[model samples]
Target chain A: MKRLLKTVKNNFLSVFFIVYIAVGMVSVCKPQALNIIDGFLQSDRSLSYLIKAPVLKLLDIRYGGVNLEPDIKLKAFYIHLNRLIQRVIGNDYIYDAGPKNDVVRLNNGYLTTCLPKLTD
Target chain B: MLFSSTVFLFAFLPVVIFGYYVIFRKSRLLQNIFLLIMSLIFYAWGEPKFVLVMMLSIIVNWALGLPAAKYRDNKVRARAVIAAAAVFNIGLMFIFKYLIFTLENINSVFGLQIPVPQITLPIGISFFTFQAFSYVIDVYRNDGEMQKNPLNVGLYISFFPQLIAGPIVRYQTVANEIKNRKETLSDFTTGVERFIVGFLKKVMLANTMAVVADAAFDAKDAISPSFAWLGALAYTFQIFFDFAGYSDMGIGLGRMFGFHFLENFDYPYISKSITEFWRRWHISLGTWFRDYVYFPLGGSRVNSKARLVFNLFVVWFLTGVWHGANWTFLVWGLMYFVILTVEKLSGIPKKEGRLLIIPKYIYTMLLVIFGWVIFRAESLGAAGEYFKAMFGFNGGTFISDDTVFYLKNNLVMFVASAVFSLPVAPLLRKKLMSAGERTRRAADAAYTAALLLMFVVAVSYMIKGTYNPFIYFNF
Candidate 1:
């Protein structure tokens, strides 16, 4: 019983630490805690920003300090090469297939930038 | 140079290893001299003037450590010498690393217009400083003998394998190996295997994941919860493989030179708690801080509770600042400190045992994934926005075409990374060892073939000029 008393006496201040942090977090960090969690779970108040986000993102990629135009060009080349492979396979009678996800619309920014235009 | 670079893979490493074995096989002196010169060249290639800085560090630490050894009987003089060594080593890092941070903070706080020094941080300043600290500290503690030769000390500090991004090698750990070590055929073979695995981890897994991570993080579109989660997950794995992979390469390179280095990481992701996570991750750094910093602060032997708090605070605060001179990094370290403190006080919830451990894993991984979100962000505000998007706070669609496309394309790579992040390779090795002799030999042969194939693929990736800078190299 004396030993238990000594142990508790020694750790009395240590035990208070848990309480101190709990109170500090609640008093200082508590207000934003729920709001932060809410931001994560609940939807934001806008439908207009949806399209703007991707455009800004791509802009960041293009002009975000590190130049990656070569990498972007390479990615475009790979996509085109993939389509060519699909077309070659489509020519085989055993693997006749409809074209998909490869229609390079001239109006699209990505396509216009990444592909050679038809020069009639 | 990056291990995954073509110059390193096809040119530098091959030439260095070949010369070490073929040309300098007879004399250990020639090998040491050769390694020292090559390491200096490797460092100088990046920062020509900063190479002199490293040499100065080596000379100063070497000079100081020898005297402390000489005056071991005189306590005060020895202490002062060690103290000077610490100041010089740490002072060098401070000027290069924290000078800009200090000036900016002072300007912001005091409303002063002190021009911040536009010094480019010397490469590997953080890593080498800690490694240098270990040498002086070890000497002070009388734990290791003072190295007599300056070349050996230089080799210990500027050892190329880990000189840049470390599993910070201790002077004491490789003290004997510096002067006298054997380069056996088996060690050489083992080193090749380890290097190949590390190379593949960086080139194949980390680099590919980095592409996905960048795309997701850089997206200006309203982030769906799915996309946010996926990017964060990819980043989490990218960082692990990138750092752990570099450490593996370092250890492998050390072995090839007949200097054995300790393993820097276990599988940290498999950890059940943040406390356990630190135990498993960047093990050398954790141990270094513990031995050099924490223990010296009367770790766990605190006479008072306040003292214990002070000790924990110091260790963790230093831990955070060690990563970078950013408030976010400081907060990241504090975040761990708070959780670790809480866990230490309240103790983690029960059911920590193996049976029904799945929930623990889920809890741990979710926290880790969240932590990575904070660590990878440009600022706290950006991190805040990201957190919201992760939980679908932003009024955005739960799915995007980009997400679906990336998921479909990179699903195989993701699955492979998930498998590799665990101990699948180690498990396979365990099974092979327990099998019969013929089975073990077959497994070894197949493993050799696999490493060779990975080497070829990694070399191709290097030739293609993938973004191959190690993430931790910035620190």
Candidate 2:
């Protein structure tokens, strides 16, 4: 018991990180938990912006900001977690049904780009 | 599951570590059994049905291993046992890995329309099968003790760390450790640090380079000469960091559980000759071919130059075919065979003096980069087209805006990859070892901080859903 305690004490940081990761995993599975995290992040405007601005910019590039729903302040967070879950289950889901800037359309045997447009 | 995946990092690894160290700490047998179960779970997470394939391998090898050791005094029976083991293991690999490729080739050659079977390869079939063969051979040769328990054999063969993509841990390397090895705090901490470094290498360096390499290789038309070189160089670094990073993580994870795997790579990019390059690159697989294939075929004890060439041809041909069922891999292996054979016959690498080091280094790297081009291509014709573009024979521009854009965006990462691929880490450790106690302590603290930062950044990349592809998993 003493040895076990000693090992635990020595590895306190590892335990904390593991717990944090577990919580993150659970949060992704639970939309309500993600909403809570979003509420927490939104409590501080500058901090939320600092954490979210680059993510939104990246989403803008790949997904054209189609998932920027009004209710979900951490839309990217949710999408990222959902995508991970989908991948783990071996299903590649396309979250953005909106205009994909990279996809080309075949218009009468000629290729044309799908022009960039933000749906949200 | 990929080591870089969130599922592995966040769920699988932590749980296994906790169970092993906390629950089964005092019991080696239980720990081994626990590890085996967890390893199966780890593999099953990717493909549930393939678990049966691995279990089949474990059971057959274990059964063969007993007779292999028992009938060692009888030459005929022993030879038969070993041959049966080889046929079973190789036949497994052949059906899953090579049957389709072989059928297609045969059909094309004979002008017949034989239908190839649709088979999904079990992940890491090559790695586990090779490890299984090593076990039986090691038991037969008395290089390692034969496990009486089938579960122990299963644990040795299916241990998750090196199971998927391996340094190809031989039975002799961990035979003793399997039964009686001590896990220490110091080893655990060092293992954590090593795992973090590998995570950074995979998630940051290799993935970033994959972006550039994929762009260049997957271009619809011929790319500029500069872009071709950049893509080739990117792929060179990408393969190194990807495989080496996985090896580091495997070794680190092995250490975390008191199993020490052999080092797979040793700064292979820094080699001055192709001979030296093979010596340092994928050392496990190279040594595997050397011991099991080359030595059994009279190795370097041949009488004639033709014999030596024949021996090398077999090894390199199998080495290429072992990588994938692609003609590209065969050509890549043959390319090395040609270079290494010339080096060996002429004794040039051995005879060269220190003055020619730079030239030798440049020559080796150029060949290696070109070799990667072949390895990365979809077909020989595609590789030829890539070479044409690389040499400005495709009427492609020398330098284009696309080339400049990629170079500018990835300059820092490219420089970092080049510097880290050298012996910088070892040199820094050597310097730190000579420092004062207080300074050493400070350096240790800084090292821990850096590791934490790297872990954060790597996990963030995982969360961000980046282009994280593992190259060696196909092999």
lDDT of 1 by residue, B51-133 (tens): 98888888888888888788888989988997898799879988988999999999999999999879988888888878877
For each candidate, the DockQ is 0.01, 0.07
Worst 10 residues of 2 chain B by lDDT: B457-466
Q: Candidate 2's residue-wise lDDT over B420-447, tens digit each? A: 8999989987899999999987877677
lDDT of 1 by residue, A1-120 (tens): 998777544443322322432332343333334444554456563544554454554345335642222233443443445444323323111110111112332323233222232111
**Cα RMSD for candidates in order:** 20.0, 9.8
Which candidate's TM-score is highest?
2
For all candidates in order, the CA lDDT equals: 0.74, 0.82
Model 2: how far is B321 from its true place, Å? 0.4
